[model samples]
Target: MNPELLIAFLASTAGAATPLVLAATGELVAERAGVLNLGLEGMMLVGAVMGFSVTLASGNGGLGLLAAMGAGALMALLFAFLVLTLQTNQVATGLALTLFGVGLSAFIGRGLVGQTVAPLRKLAFPVLSDLPFVGPLLFRFDAMVYASLLLTVAVGWMLARTRLGLLVRAVGESPHSAHAIGFHVIALRYGAVMFGGAMAGLAGAYMSMALTPMWVEGMTAGRGWIALALVVFATWKPRGVVLGSYLFGGVTVLQFHGQGFGLAVPSEFLSMLPYLATIAVLVYICRDPKTILLNKPLSLGQSFRAD
Candidate 1:
């Protein structure tokens, strides 16, 4: 491969992985607190539409990003209330949330279909951004790519070294015990779930505003499911989430360029590459029962009540 082409490929891979990093990192946090949110796809769709609509209307990418996160958080609050307060089944409520987000975003965005908004402008640092190959590969990405990486590091450090991380981990590992010790397990889980939603929303916004810069109904195209699988693939670790996301992102990017490499494969099979990689990783991971048993949050997917 030519050096310039290779640089572009790596850069595209980073961009492709950004949303997954954002979503999976958020999901990792929520799961660390023992909440399983399956409505990620819905939240992403809602966020995508909300962000695009807001940005198009306001002409501000920042506000659009904020709206996306807010929309996602609101959806998550609904999920949290159902599972935490009402004690509904976590899996069922999450699935319902996804369905609701799908329909709601479509309804809200009905008028905005086929509309185009400017992609989020990439940030530049004077001389840094002008450097030959390094500039385009690293300095040319938009704000969200850097934000995702920072978020991952912060989460990892918190989980491993901070008191708050200890408490969250405690809640996830044994909510009843944490509750007995006055940890307010329900409230903690609520916060975690909402955070996850906001991140999912951010991911969606990236898709609409940066990746393709257009709204199509269901633009998320199952990236939410891929993010979910990513958490499992990462064994719920923050760093692992980044690595796994990039791996999937590379697969996704590669598929798009597969024909260019003269591989003689059909476009359809190339398109399936990302999903196939996801399933293959999952199956490979599941083959080791100990990996799942040791890393999975003990109370994950279970409803908890203060009573």
Candidate 2:
């Protein structure tokens, strides 16, 4: 490919992967704390609508991103209350959250369906952005792209280096032991879940305000599900999540650009590339039982009653 085409492809790949990175990284944190939040899709939908509405009304992308986080955290708070406090089934409650988000976002977003907002402006380095090859590849993205990368690194450091990270890993590995040692298991899980929700929400906002800059019902499509699968594919590691997200992002962008490259495949088949690759990756990663057993949080999806 030409330098220009390569630059565009790389740029688009990062944009496509940004939301996944944010959502999966958040989910990774929660999972590490022994909580499984399956409502990612719902949280993202709510965030997308909330961000779009706020940005459109206030014309402030930053505020829109904040609103999206709040909306996502609110949804997550509900999930935490049910699963952690009320002892509801994690799977059922998460699925319900997704359903609720879909219905609620659609209800509120009906009026704003066809409206558009100015896409979030890119933050470019002066001379660096003007460089021939690596410039557009690295420097022309909006703030969220950079934020996602930073978030990933931060999460990795927190999980690997911090004392809090040790507690989180212990809680995930065996909450009973952590509890015996005086950690508040429920509180920690709640914090993780809320953080996950906030990140997922920011990701959704990135979709509406930056990626597409429009509102459509179910606009997240299956990206939320893909993000969930990405967590498993990454074996709950922060760096793995980033790599997996970017890989999927490349697949997603490639399908769109396939026609431009004179590929003979049908557009429909090309569109399935991302999802199909997701399934392939899941199967490949999961076929090894040891990988799942060794990496997955031991107390993941289990209800922990402090009594």
Candidate 3:
């Protein structure tokens, strides 16, 4: 590829990775808090539909993004009610939430199939976007890209460096212990889960309103499941999630552009590359948890009961 094409491709890769990075980071935090939400796909779909729908109606992409966040948090709250408050089966409840979000989004998006949204403004740093080729590749991006990067760093620091982070970790590792010490494990989990939901919503919204500039049924195209897989692929680490997302983005983009090189690959085979790559990564990532504690949050997918 030429310099300009390579630069453009790299830039697209970064933008494509942001949504996954943001959503996976949020999920990493929620799992770290000992909550397993399998409904991320559904939540993202709902966010995509609602975000675009609201933006089309209100003409404010920010408000639409906020609304998407609220919608995601609300769905997560429902999941919390089932698993946390009622002490239901976490896996089953999460799947239920996914089902609900899918159906709800399909219904809500019926009339929004062709609607349009005003995209969010791109954020440019002074001189940073004016640098050489690398500047165009890295500097000129929408605000969400920077926010996603900062979010990953902030989450990593929170999980590793702060007292509150300690409490959140405590809640995930051993909620009984956290509760015994007045950490309010239930509350912490809810907050984390809601954050995950909202972020997933924003990720989905980014696709419909920003990337594609319109809504479509199942527009997320399994990005949600990819995010879930990334958590395990990263061993529940924040920084790993970023690398994994970017890696996924690269493979995804390559599948589309790889044909131009005239490799001996079949078009049908190339079409399945993303899903195949996900499976390959998972197999390589967490084959054995004994050697790697990165599989997931220990308390994840469990019922937390307190006296």
Candidate 4:
């Protein structure tokens, strides 16, 4: 491949991975707190529509991003309330949340279909953005991309080094123990879940406002599920999440460019590449049960009652 083309491919891969990085990082935090909220698709969809609609009406991408995070966080709060307060089954409630988000987003976005808004502007550093190949590769992405990288590092540092990370890990590993020790397990989990939702929403907003700059029903196209898979693929580690997200992102970008590269494969098969790679990676990962058993939060997916 030509040097410039290779640079573009790398750049596109980074952009493609940004949403996954954001969503998966958030999900990792929630799961680390032992809350397995699986409604990421719903949250992302709602966020996408909300971001698009808000940006269109207000003509401000910043507000649109904030609205998207709020929307996602609200949806997550609903999930947290049901599972935490009501003691509902986490899996069932999460699935239901996804369904609700999908329908709700479709309804809210009904009028906004086919509408277009200016894509979020990429941040440019003075001399940095103008450098030959390095500039476009490193400095030309929108703000969210940089934010995703920073968020990943922040989450990793917190989980590994901070006292708060220890508490969250303690809650995830043994909520009863954490609660017995005077840590508010329920409250901690709630915060983690809401954070996850906000991140998922931000990812969705990026899809609408920056990635494609338009709204379409089901525009998230199952990236939410992919993000869910990403957590497992990363073995609940932030660094692993970043690596896995970028790998998947590369797959996603490759599928888009497969035909352009003159591969004789059908576009339909090419479209399946990212998902297919996900399944393949998961199956491979699952082959070693110890890898999962050792890394997964012990209290994950279990509802806790303070009684």
State the number of backbone clashes in model 1: 0
Off by over 4 Å in 1: none
TM-scores for the candidates: 0.98, 0.98, 0.95, 0.98
lDDT of 4 by residue, 145-248 (tens): 89999999999999999999999999999999899989999999999999999999999999999999999999989899999999999999998989998999
Q: After aligning candidate 3 to the native by TM-score, how far in Å is the CA of 142 from where it should be?
A: 0.8
Model 3 spans > 4 angstroms off = 262-264
Predicted model with the maximum TM-score: 2
**Global fold similarity of model 3 (TM-score):** 0.95
True lDDT of residue 195, candidate 1: 94
Query: How well is each residue in 181-257 modelled by candidate 3, as lDDT tens digits?
Result: 78888888999999999999999999887778898988888898899989988889998999999988877776666
Give me the overall lDDT of model 3.
0.86
Ranking by lDDT: 4, 1, 2, 3
True-vs-predicted CA distance for residue 271, candidate 2, Å: 1.0
- Model 3: pairs clashing at backbone N, Cα or C within 3 Å: 235-294
Please list all clashing residue pairs in model 4, or write none if there are none.
none
lDDT of 1 by residue, 138-234 (tens): 8999989999999999999999999989988989999999999899999899999999999999999999999999889999999999999999998
Summed backbone clashes in each candidate are: 0, 0, 1, 0
- 3 or 4, greater by TM-score: 4
lDDT of each: 0.93, 0.92, 0.86, 0.93
lDDT of 2 at 20: 98
Report how far residue 179 has shifted in candidate 1, in Å.
0.6
